[model samples]
Target: MKEKLGVVPFWQGYDRKEVLKIARIAEDLGYESIWIPEAWGYEQFQLLTEIAKETTRIKLATGIANVFSRSAGLLAMSTATLDEISEGRVILGLGTSGKNVVENFHGTPYRKPLTRLRETIGICKTLWRGERLTPEQSTLAELRHFKLAMTPVRADIPIYVASLQPKAVRELGRIADGWVPTFWPYEHFNEGLEWIAEGARDAGRDPSEIELAPFLGVVPIEDVDFARSALKPMISFYIGGMGTYYHDMFCRFGFTENADLVRDLYVAGNKQESIAAVSDDLVDAIAICGSPEHCRERLGEWRANGMGHGLVGLSPGATADSVEFILKAVAPA
Candidate 1:
């Protein structure tokens, strides 16, 4: 079966107008969804709100809003507000973003990501259902004694969990409306899905009911070396400095033994060495590169692995025109 494809804005330094233009184009091209990520620049909610207004059909999702950065109630409120604005076309993608972002950026300790995610989802669901909430201290306890003063336009907003580890992905299957994993190779998803299915069965829910949304870097260049060059900085950043001991996904990719060495090499300004360290097999597995036809084949692999939503993280140099061209070339009519 042919699968639907979406797009994620890298959100470099584009102004709001440029961002909205991209959104309009994505919508025009029939992209399934448009995701806005939160990190260094503009706030996710604000950008999503603008995109929601600019486009009418495409779904708007927070590629991820870190759970540690906002209180459960506040996060719930944000999701509720966005849902209202978008008229129920919002997918709240939540995550326990690494210790780097949590501690360094949000000034919060990154402890018990699993517990935090569970509580945040529970609280958000309750708020969306218009249940009253009472302030609670524990991560697992439910406080649905207080209700939102304003009525929610729609009570059912999908919540997708952004997880990299196996345990978290399983937890997402148990409770979240969808799964959002990054840098996962299509071939490796079966193992991850097994964990998710286990979680679903434990919760007495069917695993197939939960949505699977995977995002990965896509550089659709004909020249293999040029594509590799374009992807080097991104690979270097994640494999090197995205996290310290606690927050790197490279370890999960079987680089556990050489993670520190890779990080040190990457940090010491040895970018070429760092990229060299990233095995060609690793790059081929996680990223969709090469010609348009090769990218379509990769997309087919992701679909066969049970991904319901495919969010394309377009390369930095891919212009909107180029992106549209690539999407048309790969996506089913």
Candidate 2:
């Protein structure tokens, strides 16, 4: 594996205080960036602010801040502020988070997700350039006339779109500075590459304009079975309980029976069975687990198939010391 890795330490069983420590260690180990996720836990930018205060070299990304939770103006302002504070080390990774999270958690309707994402991107860029929002772009008549007061540190802050569906995935070719995807099956993954190229051609943009930066889950323990055990529950949760997207994706990847069983068992409240339903083969296709050597080999496989930067999140049950060891063992060579 080459040196194209980024660290994301917001997985289950991770100690909150240890996140900054890991970020510092990763920067020292020559990792490219650190991506902080915002779901139900700590706010993404605040955590990145702390990391920005602690480390100086590595880039900082939002991992994903969804479009629905915050208005486009707010997202632009906060990201601009963070970009200034971080001294131009910000990558605003945007996504349409699941319907449950947007509606149930944020109390916002999840209609027209792709449209909101496209609108949010356009608005954020417009504000970043110190330009007023146009009448057609704003939902409110009053919203169109105001521009950001302070100049952003960088006008073109990199925006990575983390989209799963084909329609939004196609949009990535036209607009994204980087593509942040997870759970794209290793085999037959070229299906997505074709879509990206098709999108670029449609938009009269070269596909090379978009960077390939996908997420890959990893369990760095030496025991393959133990690592699989740790990874299965998370996979099951995403495939079954999280939403229909993951299940539909796996089905699209030719795992219809497996995906169906996992969802059915999970919906029936048989979590253990749902976890058990996740096969080791599927895990291998989607993640890198097992011994350090095995992880290194699996990473090489993905890179061989066109994975660029590796934004790896260790599986649950990783400790500070264990993470340090894993980082060293699997550090890009």
Candidate 3:
């Protein structure tokens, strides 16, 4: 059986043309989607629009749009316009990025994230519904009372929320049509599903209604050691200094010792040490690496274990040949 897979290219440090090539390749290979992430790098809308022009069938999404950066109504407008351009193949992946990006980079305070996200989705839907966004509804983002100037071509576009914390996951279950989780090892995937189910039950929504799409880092290199080493920096970065939120989440997922050591090494300016400290076991559990056969086997396991939709994050060292190999190996039938 073919598993659902989406390509998530490294947005920064790569040539724009190459990224577009990967998207076209994935579409040609029958991958389900291509997700573009916005993280202190390129804007997603322009890039996604450009990508839409290149690919014919694969769905496009904002691996995530930071809720703190743009108002909810604007997000709705952007999604509507992109959906129109993509001919209704756009998925709005929304999230509250770490405090560092929100406060430091965007100059916006990250406040009441759970409520903010819930309200943001509601506001977006309200605008899409062509209803008047009243001041009473505007209390969250200070949204003004107004209706969309034009009717959206597809008002019911899917909205997926990127979440890790239990509360956020629960809320995602309640409101989002899908969930995008990072650092979710296969062993702990069910834990997140349960949290989402709890919220679905609370809201009287079917748990199956929400799609489970996890971001997976894949390193398909001939040398096992090289693949593991290549992924260590990224794994260590997220488990260490990305933010206390992610660090705490990793600890809760039963990586307390590794998380602590990685964070300590990273903070002490021992960046190399931090990378070295990321054990092969942790990396293997969270990512797929090694030979092509091994990576294909893991992809099968992921599909069997409820990976309905997967966002594949390629290693920085991935070449054109390696990416094409992955596309064929994991292509959805």
Q: TM-score, each model? A: 0.90, 0.94, 0.95
lDDT value for candidate 3? 0.84
Q: For candidate 3, write residues 250-302 as lDDT tens digits.
A: 78878889889999999889999999999888888788887777888888787
Q: What CA RMSD would candidate 2 show? A: 1.9
Segments of candidate 3 deviating more than 4 angstroms: 317-322
TM-score of 2: 0.94
Which candidate model has the greater lDDT, 1 or 2?
2
Q: After superposition, how far is residue 67 of candidate 1 from its true place, in Å?
A: 0.6
Instruction: For candidate 2, list the clashing residue pairs, or say none.
Output: none
Question: Which of candidates 1 and 3 reaches a greater lDDT?
Answer: 3
Q: Weakest 10 consecutive residues, lDDT, candidate 2?
A: 135-144
Model 3 CA lDDT for position 311: 90
